[model samples]
Target: MKVIAFGASTSSSSINKALATYTANLIEGADVQVLDIANYNVPMFSEDTEKEIGQAEGAQAFLRDLSEADAFVISFAEHNGHYPAAYKNLFDWATRIDRSVFGEKPAVYLATSPGPGGAQTVLGAAVGSAPYFGGNVKASVSVPSFYENFDLDTGKVKNEEIASQLKEAVSALN
Candidate 1:
């Protein structure tokens, strides 16, 4: 299966990216594409901007990514209890291209943060929005204090419980 995994953050040193990358690797026999939101940079989503440029390169790229994927794995990085600006912008651009970019494709939604809440609010918001945008909603997980649970060098889960949960989420995707 062709799977596309990405962190919603555009930060170069995003722990969310690490988590998504690690999760993508756990799924066997899948062609995984680890995408960085930075690759698709837009001026920012706005009616004024859209009226001027129609759609930017980034918006088109977002649509292309969805069009090519059989399944999606996204680990959202919360910024103040909500989606990151970069990701939200991408979502805006995607909706402009196709109202339902997800196209009811199965996905493993994830979230992570430095605190114990593990970006739960943002994950919940996305989960609620998923069905509206054609997400199959296969599984979900939240990794709290990602730095504590993941080993950067080995790219393995240090917390056994979280690792097991991650495995179960991935298995559900199949």
Candidate 2:
């Protein structure tokens, strides 16, 4: 199986990115592709911009990239308790290119932040939106108080209970 992983954030040092990378690697024997939304550089989506510039090559390429994966691992970063600008732009543009943005791929949705909310607000948004975008969310996990729950150097969950929860989620993917 092939898996594509990404954090829905563009920050240079994002906890979401770290969590997504770790989650992606946990799947056994699956080929994984990690994407940074910042690299795509898709401009903000608007009907006017869409009409003027047409489809961006980068956005089209991202759709192609999504099509290549059988599964997806996304860790969303909450910006003002919602989607980040870059990620929202990319998602909007990609959806316009193809309604089935996820291409019916199985997905593991994750979120993390320094605070205790664990980016739950955005994760909830994804849970509601994923199905409409052709995503089959096989699992969803939240890493709350990321700094306290995850070990930066070890790249693993610091708390055993959270680790067990994650293991269960990973098992559901298979």
Candidate 3:
């Protein structure tokens, strides 16, 4: 099976990114593609832009990636208890190009943060919106107090209980 993984945040040191990458690595015998949304550089979605220029090069490339993936792993990073601006922008543009970007693909939705909430608010919103984009959420996990619960450099879960829970959740996707 093929799996594509990415975090919703653009930050270079994103804990959510680490969590997604770690989860992707856990899947056995699966081809993995890691995406950085910052690399896409999509402009904010607007009907005017779409009518005039059509989809941007970045959006088209991202759409192609989505089309190629058999499964998706997304780790959301909360900003003000909601989705980050950059990720939301890319998602908006992708949906405009194809409202169902996920195309009924199975997805593992994850979230991580330094605080106790662990981006759960954004994760909840994503879970609600995922179906609209053709995503079938197979599993979801929230990694709270990420820095305390995980080792950043090694991508190891420090809390065994949380680790087991996350493993179980990702296993469901497989």
Native-to-model Cα distance after best TM-score fit, residue 52 in candidate 2, in Å: 1.3
Candidate maximizing TM-score: 1
Per-residue C-alpha lDDT of model 3 across residues 1-174, encoded as one tens digit per residue: 899999989999888889999888788888989999889977677889878788887888888998998898899999998899998888888888899988898899999899998889999999998999998999999988998999977778889998888778778877
- Against the hidden true structure, what lDDT does model 2 obtain? 0.88
Candidate 1 local accuracy as lDDT? 0.90
lDDT of 2 by residue, 41-94 (tens): 777788999999999777898898888998888999999999998898888898
TM values, all candidates: 0.97, 0.96, 0.96
Give the top-scoring candidate (lDDT): 1
What is the model-wide C-alpha lDDT for candidate 3? 0.88
- For each candidate, the alpha-carbon lDDT, in order, equals 0.90, 0.88, 0.88
Q: Please, what are the lDDT tens digits per residue for candidate 1 over residues 52-164?
A: 99978888888887779888889999999999888898888888888887988889999999999999999999999998888887999999988899998998889999999
lDDT for position 81 in model 1: 93
Q: Which window of ten consecutive residues has the lowest lDDT sum in model 2?
A: 165-174
Residue 76, model 3, lDDT: 95
Error of 2 at 106 (Å): 0.9
